[model samples]
Target: MSATISPLAPKKYPKMPVIEGVRIATAEAGIKYRNRTDLLAMVFDPGTAVAGVFTKSKCPSAPVDYCRQNLSAGKARVLVVNSGTAKAFTGKKGRASTALTGEAAAKAAGCSESEVFLASTGVIGEPLDTNKFSHLLAGLVKDGKPDLWTEAAKAIMTTDTYPKVASQTVKLGDADVTINGIAKGAGMIAPDMATMLSFIATDAPIAAPVLQDLLSRGTAKTFNAVTVDSDTSTSDTLLFFATGKAGSRGAPKISDPKDARLGAFRR
Candidate 1:
């Protein structure tokens, strides 16, 4: 299904560069919504570092569980996400569903099953039929396009009125770096006020721990302070990616949001 956008979806889409070793694709598995894309998958390089923030809810989704269990690895190559079914409950099935999704995405992307990341949004406590995704997996991959920016925003949505996107290009002297980000928010917004689900991709090279530190520090100012309905959602996620395309040495880690140098990117 085609995505719904406020105005021109394509032109308004955020074109995130395919980093040195990353590629992304989204599909419409009819998990919940019909006639529109709903599943999202992102494939990273062999050594891509990973950092994340998730819901503080006592109960979380299967994808959240899978990520929490493997986050210690601190590395990823692919990310598989689905909307229309939050999979927050349903016990074992939810967990199995997440694993299946991750494994399937890994197969298509040609990476270890564990290396695949997963996330889900929408209705909670319902069982997700992994079969739905299994059938769409191949076609979803074959039809993948590098220009599905707006579709990414529309796919993960729960009830967002407008697609949330932001971009910043920061310079590192000889070469400049660019950061493109997309987010979904509408209700269940109160966090520890922790950062929400934000995915940012950059063309600079940075260490994993350093990237994690950067995201933690950056959130205190932007995502953590916002409010939508005073209620927080069961799923909150954020990630930062370094395409390693800028060729910067020992990338600067800005743990302090006020680090003047980051001001340009932060804006």
Candidate 2:
């Protein structure tokens, strides 16, 4: 979500400019809520770098499983997220459903299944209807775009009172790059990560490894440092996507957390 004049916090969230090389789509696939967008898909530029942090819990959602395995591929072309029914504890079917969603996302975005990152949040133990993905995802091509960040953030929320968003600009080579982030957590926040979901995007050029390091440290400070209740959900997820289309802006190299560049990045 871009920055805004939110009454909940009275802090203005940035009205972020649309990042280049990204497409977004949302639909009420009936995975849970009715007449509301419950599913969101983001198609990144083919060369985008992606990184993620998941709940330390061994028991995770089917979509979480899909992401964990695909992360090994070290690339992501699209992200498919849903709220309402978190397909956790359903064992094999959960895994299968996640795989199905990834496949559908790949096809819709013209990428491989391994390039899709998936996540879900909502009622646990309920078997997710994987068919809904094919039916609803087919229509997202027209709805997905960089400006839908806020909708995407809110769609994945479980118990958040107000949507969380942050944005900043940094120098990437000769060009100025911007990072936009959104988080959801009002309950179930504790432990290794917290029952929260966050996505941060930037228009810069960075290797996936460097991006992962920055994301790990950033989340450790922000989400890991905050809490409301003392429970962490099985669906906790964090992701960072770098759309390299921002051109060859020479961003200062981020070597360690102590590097002064992170001050611009983390802020």
Best by lDDT: 2
The sequence of per-residue lDDT tens digits that candidate 2 reaches over residues 1-267 is 223434576355567667777777777777665676777788788888888899978788877777878776667888888877888898988888888887787888788888889888878898887897666776685457778777776677655545567777776545688888777665677875677777778877666777887778777787778666777789888988888766655655443445555555555
lDDT of 1: 0.69
* Total clashing pairs for each candidate: 6, 13
lDDT of 1 by residue, 240-260 (tens): 776565664444554443455
Candidate 2 Cα deviation (angstroms), residue 261? 5.6
- Runs in model 1 deviating more than 4 A are 1-20, 139-143, 193-196, 248-267
Among all windows of 10 consecutive residues in model 2, the one with the lowest summed lDDT is 1-10
After superposing candidate 2, which stretches have Cα over 4 Å from the reference?
A: 1-12, 248-263
